[model samples]
Target: MRYTFLLYSDRADSAQMTPEDWAREKEVYGAYIGALQEAGVFIDTDWLHPAETATTITRKHGEMRVQDGPFAETKETLGGFFAIDVPDLDAALAWAEKCPAAKTGRVEIRASAMGDD
Candidate 1:
């Protein structure tokens, strides 16, 4: 099965990260990604820009509407994601537990609906 791990964290926390903290964070995530790659389960991964950069589009009453920033106002914003192929939910959960965000933020695991993974 293929699962995507959506990482969410408080934007304020990221904003407070010092240069050293950012470097350490990179190293931590690097190790996590390396582990996934070594296990041959890594599919894809990416970090998103701040939520303020997002552009939202919606259609209602046959009219199109555009909005700036994220659709929801929340303390935690989606920061990144990792797509991996694992055997089952248990395997996916294990991987998600190892993610750095799982410690400080949230990791939402969603199985792929395509069923080809």
Candidate 2:
């Protein structure tokens, strides 16, 4: 099965990190990605720009509306995602738990609805 791990964190918290801390954080994520690749389960991964750069679109009453920033206001915003192929929910959960974001933020694991597309 394929699962996507959605990473969420507060941009404000990241902005407060020291340069050294940021570097270390990147190093940790690199190591984690390396592990996933070594396990041959890494499909794709990417980091998103801050939510402030996001654009939201919606349709209501047959009218299209465009708005700036995220749709919902929250302390944590989606920061990145990892797509991996694993055997089952247990495997996915195991991988998710190892993600760096899981420690400081949220890691939402979702199985692919379209299968291996």
Candidate 3:
């Protein structure tokens, strides 16, 4: 089965980290990605730009409405995601545990919809 891991974190808090801390965090993530690739569990992954760069679009009364930033305000913001093929939820959770965001933020692990196949 394939699982989608949605990583979320507080951009404001993360921005406060020192350069050294940021480098260390990136090193951890790089190691995790290397491990995943070696195990052939990595499908795809990417980091998103800050929410400030995001644009929201909606349809209101048959008209297109455009706005800035994410649709909602919250302490946590969507940071990145990874799609991985694993044997079961346990395996997926194991991988999720290694995700950097899991330390101070959140990692939402969900199985892909069957209809998506």
Candidate 4:
């Protein structure tokens, strides 16, 4: 089955990263991705721009409403995601725990809907 990992983090933590620190962070995550590929479970992954660049849209009373930033504000913001296929929730959870972001943030694991293919 395929699962989606909605990664979230405190934006402030990222801002504190030095150039070298950021580079090392990428290297660490790259290894994790590599591991997934070796295990034949990797599908896709990516990083997202800060929430400042986000545009939120909603429908209210038959009209579309737009907001300039994220729909809500919190210490933790949506960072990125990973989509992978694994045999079961336990396997997906293992991958989620291995993600570097999980050290300081969260990886929300969700099974893909049956028709997503």
Candidate 5:
């Protein structure tokens, strides 16, 4: 099965980290992804730019509306995601726990929707 790992973190708190810390964190995450790829389970992954760069589109009073930023303001913002194929939920959780974001933030593990693309 394939699982989606949603990484969420506080952008403000992350921005406060030292330059060295940031660089090291990036390196560590890169290595983790590389390991997943080597294992042949990595489907796709990407990091979002930032909440400030996001645009929200939704229905307002039965009319389509467009707005700036995410739908809701919260302490944690979704920063990235990893889609990996694994044996079961246990394996997916294992990988999610390995995510660096799981340390300071959160990693939401959810099975991919069942349907034809």
Candidate 6:
């Protein structure tokens, strides 16, 4: 089965980290990614740009409306995601727990919808 892991974190708090802290965080992420690759569990992953670069589009009444930034205000914003194929949910959950952001943020794991292939 394939699962999508959505990583979320507080944009404000993440942006407040010092350069060294950021570098260390990146190193941790790199290490985790390397481990995934070595284990052959890595399918795809990517980091999203800050929320400020996001755009929200909606249809109101019959017209399309577009706005800048995220669609809604929240303490935690989606920072990235990982899509991987695993034998079962248990294996997916194990990977989620090992994610670096799992301690300070959240890693939401959802099985990919059926017939996606």
Model 2 Cα lDDT, one tens digit per residue, 18-61: 99998999999999999999999999999999998999988876
Predictions in order: lDDT: 0.96, 0.95, 0.92, 0.93, 0.91, 0.91
Give the top-scoring candidate (lDDT): 1
lDDT of 6 at 23: 92
Candidates ranked by lDDT, best first?
Answer: 1, 2, 4, 3, 6, 5
Model 5: residues >4 Å from true position, as ranges? none
Least accurate 10 contiguous residues by lDDT in model 1: 108-117
Error of 4 at 92 (Å): 0.6
lDDT of 1 at 109: 99
Error of 1 at 53 (Å): 1.3
Tens-digit lDDT track of model 3 for 11-80 = 8878889999988988888998999999999999998998778999988689999999889988889989
Candidate 1 wrongly placed segments (more than 4 Å):
none
What's model 6's overall lDDT? 0.91
Runs of candidate 2 exceeding 4 Å displacement: none
Between 4 and 6, whose TM-score is larger?
A: 4
Error of 1 at 78 (Å): 0.6
Candidate RMSDs in order: 1.8, 1.9, 1.7, 1.7, 1.9, 1.8
Q: What lDDT, from 0 to 1, does candidate 3 have?
A: 0.92
For residues 19-53, could you state the per-residue lDDT of candidate 5 as single tens digits? Answer: 89979988999999998999889999999998878
lDDT of model 1 at residue 79?
97
